[model samples]
Target: MGIKIGIIGAGGMAAYHIAGFRQAGAEVVALCDPNEAVARSAAAAHGVSRVFGDAESMFAALPELNAVSVIVPNKYHAPLTLQALAAGKHVFCEKPPALNALEMAEMKGLAERNKRTLMFNFNNRARPESVAMMDYVKNGEAGRINSAQAKWVRRTGIPGFGGWFTNKVLSGGGALVDLLHMIDLSMYLMGYPEPAWVLARTFDDFITDRTFKGPWGIPDAVNGVNDVETAAHGFVSFKTGQALSFQISWAEMVQREEVSAAFQGTKAGGMLRRLYGADGVDATATDLCEFYTQDHGRSSNRVVTVESDPDMGRVRSARNFVRSIEGTESPLNTPDQALILMKIIDGAYASARSGEPVKL
Candidate 1:
């Protein structure tokens, strides 16, 4: 028997999912979106013959679908995932998991009760640079990481003026939630220790500034809500006595866009970074991965080289999801790790609001 897959939310991310699943040898049977025309267009483009306007109709019509890929908005991730899990289907969802920790918990619980695989697209973990760094960490060459720094800052990079990315209710938060890859990557390399507390602050300095819109081409809404912060800085302490500091922003007064994660371990330190010529444009980015250690009591820096990923592991991560379901590979991220990530994000927002540290 082969893996039969259905996709929910026929949007930009769904195209990536379709490509990945097909590359993994899975049969993409159907695609669904609220807009019937969009769904039909995507299905035709992807070679899928079936199309529907909603998830309920798709599920009711297709009984052989054992798995689903969810590429919807932040607000629909949980409900759609729970629905799929309850219907006895494995699920692969996009980043941030859900709006907050509570929603993530519900999604996790339902998946467990249904005995289905639940994975998130923490695609950075599948990047060649990240894969190289993990080999060293797992082999004890990096030793125990004591502290780390994660950053994804851009100098004029708001996604849109009034899209869901800027609405707190729809998108949860701003850059902190949308650009959470580095934070999750740092924690993964550190063995995913339990987080204890978070102290943070957020700024909306450029939240309503149209001049800072990103180059992605997502059009601005007419008279739409834009209430999310543009920047967030925070620190997290874990139960293992390790710590992580992060800076995430869509708009800030910076030299250029940078995505990086640096960690200091007991024996050595390492860094992985991508410097971009322009925000939201992957073609203009340069990547770096290196390790710092001692060679005969002298400082030594070794550069880790690998083939560059144009999609930043987006499609590769999806293939991993399919392979994991086939029992040929383990998932790069688990539901429990996603829950922790959301908890940290939730804590950061709460701390920012109360002007004090939130103890998780």
Candidate 2:
């Protein structure tokens, strides 16, 4: 029999998980959300047998569930993950692991104590181009990665203009949490080095200005809160003497949206670009991966072609999670890695607030 899966949070992210689980051949047995109507609708749409208004009830009703995808808000990640582990269910949590480093660390410890597999849904790392890039770096084809620059900028984009996404207490932070995928993938490609310190700055330039809200119109801006930064820039230094510079923005006055990462090693360099538009969809363009090398004392660049499947990583991640539960394969995105990445994010925020470099 295949692994039995459950989906928490019947929102858009849950739908994303459902597609992947189905593609991976896992049976989604249950669906849960705080909103009863949402849960029922998702269950009907996804052909799930049961639905619950909350996670506790879902876990209680379905004891046979082997794994669950926790696709809730950032603040609930730690609590839900811990509860799922204690209940003997492996958890696959959505990205930005938790609201802070402390919560991530606690989740990691709890997962270890329960001997449960905890996986982060960092799907971007599973992309074909990303896999090839990782292989190149790990095989020493790029030598020791020393410097990297990654950016995910938008011309005018702020999700949920005044809702939980723009609220610091609910979503952790703005661009960092929402767009940290690029940063994490870049670091992963560089061997997951220990972050030494970070010098960072954040700005909330367009929160009060309605003109900056492009696609995500501000219907709730008046009553809702907007305390999070709209843009963030950080210079991260690793213990291995390597470094990365990143700038991510939710709303800014720029030419166009750019999602790209470039790494320079001691011997060679490489770059990857996702050709999605400012809305992050309508991919009329294909991804580009290029490597810079010196061949016979002459500088040369080679383009690496990767098969494009936007949802391939999510499907791969679902299959990998099931394999982990079966003890056939280890998880690719572990809670330990989440904790380290959270620390870097925390340090960046602290550094920005104190106006000084924060040490890890």
Candidate 3:
């Protein structure tokens, strides 16, 4: 039988999972959300037979569920994973895994103890462009990755002014966390190097200033505490002595969203020509999303480039996860790697807060 999958949230991403699972021939048995109407609506729309508000209740009722896609908020990642593991279900949780380092560690530990497959969805790492970049880096096509950069820049995204996103207690932090997709991808491409230390700085006033143009085009004057930083920058040193600089902003008054990773190797180098929805600050572009690379033999400083559709990443990631659940392959994003990502983020925040470099 195919892998029996369950989608645990009815938010915007739930539909993506539903469609991807169906395309992969995995059986999506249930849709769980607190809202009955939302649950039923998702189930009906996705052709799922089961819809339940309470997760524990649904798990008890549906013993055949083999896996679940936890697409809830960052705070709920831990509890939901723990609950799913206890229910004997494997998990594919969204990025950042959990709210903090402790919770993330505990959930990963629980999954291991239960012998359940716990995967974090770092879909950006699986992007076609990223795959091509990885090939170049691993094949010595890009020499030793020395100094690298991974950044995310956005015009404006002070989401739901007074909502959970602004509440650091709920979302952990703002753009630093909300827009960390590039951080994960950059780390992956760098062979998951161990960070010796990190220095981080954050800025939260951009949103409160109400001078930036909003992403969804909201009014100039929006109300919120802006407790979370709308921007964060960090520099990291790896055990290999290689370094990576990171930056992400949501409320900046930049021309456009620019999300990318640039890797500088000893013999060769490359970068994500375009990442996320970013069009490389080009307003009249459709964002082809290229992966460009340059080797030692090339002196022009211009790398060769390859481009493809960007929307295919989510589908590709979901298909991989479902296949892993069916025992046809191993988990795409292992818990070990996910844990490392969490630790790096945690260290960055610490360094940013104490104004001292944090040893990772």
- The best candidate in terms of TM-score: 1
Model 1 alpha-carbon drift over 4 Å, by segment: 279-284
Ranking by TM-score: 1, 2, 3
lDDT of 1 by residue, 46-125 (tens): 89999999888888999999899998878889999999999999999998899999999999999888889999989999
Model 2 bad stretches (over 4 Å) = 214-222, 278-286
How many angstroms is residue 350 displaced in model 3 relative to the true structure, after the best TM-score fit? 1.5
Error of 1 at 293 (Å): 1.1
lDDT (C-alpha, whole model) for all candidates: 0.92, 0.84, 0.76
Candidate 3: regions farther than 4 A off: 209-225, 275-283, 286-307
| Model 2, residue 85: C-alpha shift (Å) | 1.1
Angstrom error at residue 136, model 2: 1.1
TM-score (C-alpha, index-matched) for candidate 3: 0.90
Give the per-residue Cα lDDT of candidate 1 at 75.
89
Q: Count clashing residue pairs per candidate.
A: 0, 0, 0
Q: What TM-score goes with each of the models? A: 0.98, 0.95, 0.90
lDDT of 3 at 202: 88
